[model samples]
Target: MNANLKGAAMMVAAMAGFAVEDMLLKSAARDVPVGLILMIFGALGTVWFAALAKSRGDRLLNRDLLHPVVGAKSLAEIVGRLFFVLALALAPLSTVSALLQATPLVVVAGAALFFGERVGWRRWSAIAIGFAGVLIVLRPGVDLGWGSVAALLGMLGFALRDLATRGAPKSLSNMVLGVYGFLALVPAGAIMLAVTGGAGVPPAAALGLIATASVVGTGAYYALTSAMRLGEVAVVTPFRYTRLVFALILAALVFGERPDLLTLLGSAVIVGSGVYTLLRSRRETQTAAAQEI
Candidate 1:
C-alpha cells in the first residue's frame, strides 16, 4: 500500500482503539471513581510511554521538558483529560464524542490568533459555522447540561493543548511528549479525587477495565503518531474524524445511546466545517509553494 493508504489505515485503527478505550473507561467508571480511573489509566500510560522512550534511547528527564511551552502543554493536558473523562462518565458517549469533533476547528482559530498564521475570510467563516454547530449541539436555551459543558471545556482544553504543542521543542520525541501528557493526569486526577472524595479500593472488574483501557489508549496514541509520520499531513489528518464514527457506533452498541437529531446535525456541521478548513489550508499552502517555485 502507498504511504497515504497506510497512514489512513493507521488513523482508522487508532480511532477504533480510542473508541474502545473510551468505552472501557466509561464501563469502569460505573464501578470505579472517575478520579481513580484516571489515576490508574494515567499511571499505566506513563509507564508504557516511558518504556517506549527508553527503548528508543530518548532521555526521559531532558531539560527541555521544563520549557515553558512544555509547561503550557502539561497544563492543557491536565484540563483536557480531567474534563473529558468527566464527560465520558457523565454524558452520553455519542454527544461527548461529537463535541470533540470541534477540537481541530478550535485549533485552527487558535493558530491564526496566536501563531500569527494568516487565515483567509473563508476559513474564518468555516470556523464560525463550526462553533455554531457546537451551539446547536448545546442548544443553550433548551436543554443544556453539565455534561455538555464538561465536553465543551474538554474540547477547548485539547485545542489549547494542540496549540501549545506547536510551540514545543523539536528535540522532544513523541514518546517523551506522551510521557509528560500522561504524567499530567496524575495531579489532575488527584485534585479531582480530593474534591469529590471518590477514592476507594476499585473492584477487580474495574481494575481489569482500567488496565485494558490504558493499553488500548497507549496503542492508539502510537498509531496516531505513526499515521502522522507516514503520510502527507493534509491527507492523513482528515481521517481523525473517523474517531467520531467509531465512537457513535460503540456508544450505540455498548451504551445503547440514541443521539437526538440535533446532535447528529450538529456533528455533521462540525465535521463539514473542519474538512473545509483543512482543504482550504492545503490549497493555500499549494498556492504559496507554486508562487515560490
Candidate 2:
C-alpha cells in the first residue's frame, strides 16, 4: 500500500487499540485507584518497549532523548494520559471519548500557529466550528463538571503531543519514543497518586486488566508514532474519528452508556468539521502540486 494508505490504516488500528485500552483502564479503575492503574499501566508499557528496543540492539539512552522537542512531547504525554485516565475513571465513557474527538481540530490549529503551516480562512472556520461542538458537548452551564474539564485538558495535551511528534528526531526509533512516552506516565501517575494518597494492592482481576491495557496501549503508541511519521498529518488524522465510533459502541455495550442528543450532535459536528479540514488540506496540497507540475 501507499504511504498515506498505510498511515491511515495504522491510525485506524491505533484508534481501535486505544479504544480497547480505555475500556480496560476504565474497567480496572472500578477495582483499583485511577492513580495506581496509571502507575502500573505505565510501568508495564515502559518495560515492554524497553525490552523491544534492547532485543533489537537499539540503545535506550540516546542523546536525542534530551532534545527539546522530545522533552516537550514527554511533558505533553504525561499531561494527556494523566487527565485522560482521570476522565475515563470519573466520567461516562461516551462523554470522555466524545470530547477526545476534538483533538485533531486542536492539532490542526496548533500546526498553523506553532509550526507556521498555512491555514486558510476555510480551515480556520472549520476549527472554530469544531471547538463550538466541544462547547456543545460540554454544555457549559448545564452539565459542566471536573470530568468534562479534565477531558478537554487531556485532549489539548494530546494535540500538543502530536504536534511535537512531527518535529521529533528522525534518529529515534518508534519503540524508543514509545519507551519515553510510557515512561512519562510513571511520574504523572506518581504525582497524582501522591496527591490523592491512595495506592493499594489491586485485586488479581484488576491487575490482569491493567496488564492487558499496558500491552494494548504499547502497541497503540507504536502505531500512533508510526502513523504520524508515515504520511501527511492531514491525510492520516481523519481516521482518528474512528475512535469515537469504537468508544461509543464499547461504552454502550460495556458500560450501558447512552449518550444524550447534545453529545451525539456535538460529536457529529466535530467529525464533520474535522473531515472538512482534511479535505481542504488535501485540496490545497493537490493545488500546490499541480502548480509545481
Candidate 3:
C-alpha cells in the first residue's frame, strides 16, 4: 500500500481510539469526581506504559533525559490533561471537543515563537480563522464558568508541550517520554485529590465504572500506537476529526446534549480549517523532503 494511504487509515483509527477514550472517561465522570478520575486514568496509563517499557527492554535511566524545556513541556501536558477532564465534567461533550480545535492554532503560534519557525502569512491566516470558529461555538457568556477556561488552557498548554517536544533531545526514547508524561500527573493528581478529597467512597458500582473507563483509555492508546506503526504518519494524522462525531453521539446519549444551528455552522468552519491545516502541513513536509533529495 502507498505509505500515505496507510498513514491516512492509521490516523483515522487513532482518532477513533481517542474518541472512545474520551467517551469512556466522560461516562465515568458522571459518577466519579474529577480528581479520582484523573488519578485512575493516570495510574492506568502509567502502568500500561511501564509494562510496555519493561517488555521492550527500554532503559529507565538514560543520560539523555529530556531537555529542561522538554520537562516543562511534559508538565504542560499534565496541566492540559487535568483541564481536559474538567472540561468534560463541565461542558457539553461536542462543545468541549470543538474547543479543542484551538490546539493546532496554539501549536502554530508556539512553533513560531519558541522554535523560531518561519510562519508564513497563509498558515497564520488559517489559524486566525480557525480560532474565530472556536469563539463562535463557545460564545462565552458570564455563565461559561471556570471549566471552559480550564479546557482552553489545556488546549494551549498541550500545544506548548508539542512545541517543546520538537526541541527535545533525540536521546530521549518514546518510553521515557511516556513515563515522564504519566509520572508528571502523579503530583498534580495528588494536589487535586487533596483539595477535592478523592471522589467520596467509591460505591460498588463506581469501581466498575472507573475500571471500565481506565480499560478503554488504555485500549485507545494501544489502538492509536498500532495505527501509527501500521500506517504512514502524515496521511493518517488527519483522521483525528472523527473525535467530534464520537463526542457528539456520546454527549447526546450520556448527557442529552443537542446542538442548535449555530453549533453546526461553527463546527463546519472548524472542520474545514482543520482539514486544511493537515493538508497544508503534509504539502510542506513533502516539499521539504523533495528539497532534501
Best TM-score goes to which candidate?
1
Output candidate 1 Cα RMSD: 1.0
Q: lDDT tens digits, residues 1-293, model 1?
A: 99999999999999999999989988988888778877888899999999989998999989898899999998998888888888988899999999999999999899999999889999999999999999999999798988889999999999999999998999998799889998988878888899889788899988998999999998998899999989988899889999999999999999999999999999999999999999899889899899999
- Which runs in model 2 stand beyond 4 Å of their true positions? 1-10, 54-58, 223-236
**Leading candidate by lDDT:** 1
Instruction: State which candidate, 1 or 2, has the greater lDDT.
Output: 1
Candidate 3 clash pair list = 7-232, 7-236, 8-235, 8-236, 11-236
lDDT of each: 0.91, 0.89, 0.73
Cα RMSDs, all models: 1.0, 2.4, 2.3
Ranking by TM-score: 1, 2, 3
TM-score, each model? Answer: 0.97, 0.91, 0.89
**Collision pairs in model 1:** none
Say what the RMSD of model 2 is.
2.4
Instruction: For candidate 1, report its TM-score.
Output: 0.97
Query: Stretches of candidate 3 above 4 Å error?
Result: 1-5, 198-200
